[model samples]
Target: MKIVELSMVLKIIPKVLQIFLNFCLVLLSLILSFLLIKELTMFLKIFMTDGSSDYKMFIANILIFFLYFEFITMIVKYFKEEYHFPLRYFIYIGITAMIRLIIVEHDHPIDTLIYSLVILILIIGYFIMNITPLERPNRQK
Candidate 1:
């Protein structure tokens, strides 16, 4: 009886922890989204006041916004897909981040080359992941 009780408690502990972590993730995502919106608004305000049209800054901010949007999407997908995070979303985020970095800071030839290589690697990984097939459960006849 004690062993059974202990096993049940152990199982319940993990479930409880998972629930708590999920709740925390949701809260953090919400907060991050709000902060992103606030930052976007501030960027707009600065652009309006400065009157200096910097396309690079504009593009960088847009990319940053997409990053935040992607993060929210990942969090939502996590809940929707039974708490499993799809690898493609992470790859997409990585690609977007790399592109943004290159756009914002491509000063050195070597650094740019390295970033390009990393992006290529990530793209290949994404392609490979997409091509891989998931195993289906065997149904007994």
Candidate 2:
């Protein structure tokens, strides 16, 4: 009887953890949505108030906004695709992040070149993923 009960508890553990993780993800999505909105508002405010004098800041904020948007979309895709995140979305995020890093922190020429290389690698990976056939391990054919 004790062994049977232990087996049941072990089975329940994964379900509980899955539920907890889903709840956390939902909360994160809400937070990111709010942040995305805030970034939009900030971008607009900067545009209207200061004109294009702060072009660097303006561009940086735009990148941040897109980053938030991509994360939210990735989370939504996660729930839609049966909790499986596609590799392409991650590669897209990586490329965007590297570009943003290059734009925002170009003080060092070597660092910017390295970030460009990273972006190039991510793009190549994305192309490779696209060319490969989709393999859904958990799908029932």
Candidate 3:
């Protein structure tokens, strides 16, 4: 009957979507790996260059390198943890990004203050998350 066929199609859709998502994630990991390599080379180049190199630019690039590294690590963690992303990695990324933003765009005092506050909030949140138990007793079987 058409109902049976429709039910079969519905069941297949989720599997197909999961496969597509996995493929996209793999492709993204590859791209991020290339970008991390490029960032490393650029960092080395900036480090080796003469005094003409901008210090702010150098710091910014280093932050960017770490950012790429963190993302790649997160992706690896994703596969290792059965496709689930831990909130800690996201917090780490947010903290790193906020620091990078502060360093690269401190031209405005107010904006810099706001960014600093945001970083503080993230750190506090991370601290709270750290202290919490991984599993609740009620959730346990």
Please report the candidate that would top lDDT against the real structure.
2
Q: Could you give candidate 1's per-residue lDDT for residues 66-137 as a string of tens digits?
A: 898899999999999999998899999999999998999999889888999999999999888878887768
Off by over 4 Å in 1: 136-141
CA lDDT of each candidate?
A: 0.90, 0.91, 0.90
Q: For residues 1-141, write the lDDT of model 2, one tens digit per residue.
A: 999999999999999999999999999999999999999999889988944697888898999998999999999999999988878888888988898898889999999999999998898888888898777679686
The lDDT, on a scale of 0 to 1, for candidate 3 is 0.90
Best model per TM-score: 2
What is the TM-score of candidate 3? 0.90
Model 3 clash pairs are none
User: TM-score of each candidate?
Assistant: 0.89, 0.91, 0.90
Candidate 2 accuracy as TM-score: 0.91
Model 3 per-residue lDDT tens digits across residues 1-141: 999999999999999998898899889989999998998898888888888559888888888988888888888898899888989899988999999999999999999999999999999999999999889668565
Candidate 1 lDDT for residue 87: 89
